[model samples]
Target: MRSYLFVPGDRPERFGKALAAGADVVILDLEDAVAAPNKAQARDNVRRAVDDGAQVMLRINGAGSQDFIDDLALLHGLPLRGVMLPKAESVGPLGELAEVTDAPVIPLIESALGLWEVMTVARGPGVERLAFGSIDFQVDLGCDGSDEALLHARSRIVLASRVAGLQAPVDGVSVALDDEAVIAAESRRSRALGFAGKLCIHPRQVAVVNAAFSPTREELEWAARVVAACERSAGAAVSVDGAMVDLPVLLRAQNLLAMAG
Candidate 1:
């Protein structure tokens, strides 16, 4: 999945619109997006949508919150695509959540404690992927939102996800809704750092995020050439554009081609 778009659960009118927004996954948000007084109503709306055959992922409240239990209760026996656990700080709570539903869990690492324990969380049972909550992470660490400031944290998430054998982590949202250039640059940077997807706040960001994560035409051609050369060489070392094509390089080219498809 290249783009995961968020739609407020309380806004039932927007649910179908979100599903039609061309995102790979639509996350019906029940956590931060819903107010306290409307939490129950939002849960009911999401349940009804699922019963109506709308496929979507749910973003539940944090583990320690009272709403967490109620959120799980709403999901009982429903056919959900997945669940996103906000402010995920440990594997214990994640394991407890797994016991409630068979859907794969996606832990959003936002706090310092959560970032430190990310490896354990990624390796936890039924974890489908990891997602970075960059805005919350900056708040927790009291740092700026510049790439330099978040590089360490971002790198750590990528390393943990790779080490745990999960899909590459999803980068956090780019808040500048009007600037497609910023969104594209950040998406490219995230992809370069081994992130397979990004969290999109608006439907407008989806196309740019998907394009950034996908292999370019030049990249696809290069990959195809390298793959053909490697196949002809029969595992022997070959040179592609003055660079020696070995096992790792050949595998990378093949992976690029597969991603393109």
Candidate 2:
């Protein structure tokens, strides 16, 4: 899954549009996007979507909040791709997650404490992956949202995900709805930082994010060549494109091929 697209839960009409937008995973958002007064209505919309078999992922509110409790109550029998837990700060809330539903939980690390305890949270019950809520993380830290400023947090989340044997972390949204170049650039930056996927807000950003994460033709060709050379080298030193094709490089090539497939 390279692109995770969010649709407001209250906007049930947009669910089909979002699904058709070609995102790897479409998320019904019950937090941040919906107003407090609309929470119940949003929950109803989500329930209806799932009841109709949408097969979408869901972004629930923080654990322990009334909305989170209600969200789980409504999610009891829904077949979803997964559940995203926002503002994840501890394992205490995540302990009961496995008991509530069998859906995989994705912890959104958006705070200093959450980042600090990322490994533990990644290892929490039902945690299948990690996501970086960069906007909220910056707000919590009172720091600039530049790539440089958020680099450390992104790196930590990626590392924690790898250590916990989860898929690579998902990067936050670009917020630039109209600019394709900027959105693609941000997604590329996330990929450079070891993120496997990007969280997208607009449907227009899906193709761009997916392109940024998916291996390009050139990359696939290079990996194929490297792999071919490695097959003949038989553990000996080899060179590909003027650079030494060492064990690590060969492994990276193989990983790229697997990702492409």
Candidate 3:
């Protein structure tokens, strides 16, 4: 899933529109996007949407909050793609959550402490992937939201996910709704850093993100040439476009083709 779009849980009227927004995954946000008094109504809306069989993920409240328990109760028997736990910093809560539902989990790393404990969180029970909550992480670290400022955090999450044998971590949302250029640039940066997907706050950001994460036509052509050269050489050392084709390069080419599929 290259683009995971978030729709405010309280705004059920927009759910269908969000589903049709071309995102690979749609997340119903019950945490940050929802206000305090509207949480209950949002939960009901999410339940109705899920019961109606929308293939979506759900972002519940923090594990330490009372809303988390209520959210779990609301999800007791429904089928969902997964649950995203915001401010996830421990494994015990996720383990308990697994006992309640069989759904996979995606832990959102949003704080300095969460960043420090990321490896453990990635290895937690039922963890399918990790996601960086870059906005909140910046606030926690008292840093600017520039890529240079958040580079270490993003790299750490990617490394932790790999070490835990989980999918590459998802990058946080880009807040500039009017700037598709900036969104594409940031998504390209995330992909270069080994992020498999990006989070989208608006439907307008989806196409840019999906395109950024996918291999371009030029890349596919290069990969195909590399693969063909490797096959002709029958695993022997060969040169492709002036560079030596070795095991690592061949493997990368193969992986690129697999991702293209």
Strongest candidate by lDDT: 3
User: How many Å off is the CA of 215 in candidate 1?
Assistant: 0.6
lDDT (C-alpha, whole model) for all candidates:
0.92, 0.92, 0.94
Off by more than 4 A, model 2: none
Over the stretch 8-124, how does candidate 2's per-residue lDDT look in tens digits? 998998999999999999999999999999999999998888888888999998887898889878778778899999999899878767777899989999999999999989999
Residue 191 alpha-carbon offset, candidate 2, angstroms: 0.7
What are the C-alpha RMSDs, in order, of all predicted structures? 0.9, 1.2, 0.8
Worst 10 residues of 1 by lDDT: 91-100
- Segments of candidate 1 deviating more than 4 angstroms: none
Evaluated at residue 26, the lDDT of candidate 1 is 98
Candidate 2: give the clashing pairs. Answer: none
- The collision pairs in model 3 are none
Clashing pairs in 1: none
Alpha-carbon error at 92 in model 2, in Å?
A: 1.5
- Looking at model 3, residue 47 earns an lDDT score of 91
- Lowest lDDT sum, 10 consecutive residues, model 3, at 92-101
Candidate 2, lDDT over the whole model: 0.92
Candidate 1 per-residue lDDT, tens place, 112-193, comes to: 9999999989999889999999999999999999999999989999999999999889999999898999999999999999
